[model samples]
Target: MMKAADLAAIRAIITRAKRWDLFFSLLGILSLMVGVLTFTVLFVDMAIQGVPRLSVDFFTSFPSRRAEHAGILSAWVGTVLVMLLTALAAVPLGVAAGVYLEEYAPKNWITDIIEINISNLAGIPSIVYGLLALGLFVYYFGFGQSILSAGLTLALLILPVIIVATRESIRAIPQSIHEGSYACGATTWQTVSDHILPYSSAGILTGVIIGMARAIGETAPIITIGALTFIAFLPTAPFAGDPPAGLFDWIFAPFTVMPIQMFNWTSRPEAAFTVNAAAAGFVLVFMTLAMNGLAIYVRYRLRKNIKW
Candidate 1:
């Protein structure tokens, strides 16, 4: 309803705001420069220390006397298995709980309590969760210092991450989809399962993957549950033996993981141990970056493809 003259006046005022654009651009460019430079320095230092130590034994042999000994085969195997198990245990439960709370729960006190606690839990120091795992998995029920204990501790540590990610994804869903499903006479579960979930699945999965990546890097909690620095036997499948090491049997067996092994090496009296430690650090960094990159790529595609 504004007159042409009025519109022209407003446009003139808006054009005046562009005068500060250069300042903002300079600030953004400077910030980016600083970040890149800092990371470049770190990468250079790590590479200089680690690349020379990268050898056949670094990947193939068990830890030995540094220059005389090589490889981290056992620690590598343990870390992968524990991380995989933690992911397997965390993703489904976290997503399901998120979905139920977001889509099905009455907006009541109990639900609010859960929502608040889950957010709060994410901020709790991971080492505290390790203590809880120690009490519950190692002492109270008697699983003891095993890979199972590490996985469970890690699962708890990452659950909050998964839940928070899932909840945000579910919350991001457009309400119109829910209303449309309701209009079509779908049951609450059906609307959530067939429509709402499919719409937000990509986001949920991305969050879970990020959570898993963080869990894979964690050392404090797993250490609290007593991840051994040395385990000679490669882990057999939990239920593959003659007695089929019952869930409790395998879950409580003493085990070693990569981070713990690195910690042990770093504490040793030899310079070779320090070099190997750096190499292991590089390996962890590379693996984490790879997983995070995949998650980001997936998120970009999902955002591009999803309607909302």
Candidate 2:
């Protein structure tokens, strides 16, 4: 029923659109490569500068006045302990808050206010969180300048991220899944436990890992809360103190993390310390990459297991 002229005009329009699409496709690839190549080049440069410094002695020794003798044992141990405490505090609370808001909280003005505040909080600068922690955790609660304070500060910093990720992940599941579960006479808790949580685990885990990656690299808040820049001794191992350490004793111990250690080295006047900084930076980047890789692996395994 179409005239030849009309067919030709329609074909021309599609051809023009296809050309534009191809242009954009190439543009997108170029943009992505620019970022990837930039990061790869920098990472390679850092490795070149730092790889030689990675040795058994570097990992085993503690900080020293001599740059050549300096190591990151104390720093890495503190980072791990702080991160463990942060995860322990943040995961359950963030997940619970997200689950409640998305599944159970009534849609009211108060809920809207809370949601808005949480979103705003996520965008606030890290330094603001540091100030808040200094006041609330350090002064009010008397947590003091210790691992407990740093862990709590970073936990608060990442809580909103996890909560947002959780809600979004839960929202993504098909409505029919919920309906089907209820149709089977499952209780609310049963449906959520048996279906919702399992289905969204990949997304939740991804968010958690991302939050932790950010937390691990945080320096401003830790410094603001009085983390020592040159701590040499490790926190007391659980149950290994002179008086037989209490279970939570280390939480109250002073600590230093990788970022602070790197900062300390980079600030030194000596060239040798600069090499140490580069090495520490390399290790930190590798840790971040490892966490991201774990996230990808988890997401893959979880999605592969999912029937839908």
Please tell me which predicted candidate would have the highest lDDT against the true structure.
2
Residue pairs clashing in model 1 are 57-71, 58-71, 146-253
lDDT of 2 by residue, 181-214 (tens): 9999998888888988888888999999989999
Q: Report lDDT (Cα) of residue 96, candidate 2.
A: 88
- Tell me the TM-score of model 1: 0.85
Colliding residue pairs in candidate 2: none
Q: State in Å the error of residue 44, model 1.
A: 2.5
Give the distance in Å from residue 115's predicted Cα in candidate 2 to where it truly belongs.
Answer: 1.4
Off by over 4 Å in 2: 1-30
Each candidate: what lDDT?
0.82, 0.92
After the best TM-score superposition of candidate 1, give how far the Cα of residue 190 lies from its true spot, in angstroms.
Answer: 1.1
Angstrom error of the Cα, residue 279, model 2: value is: 0.8
Total clashing residue pairs per candidate?
Answer: 3, 0
Quick one: best TM-score, which candidate? 2
lDDT of 1 by residue, 1-308 (tens): 98999999998888777656877888999999999999888777777887788887778777665445766788888888788779878888898888878877898999989988888988899999999988998989787787777887888888888887887888888889899999999999999889888888888889888988898789999888877776666666667788686654554556777788778878888887777887887888788888899899999998888776
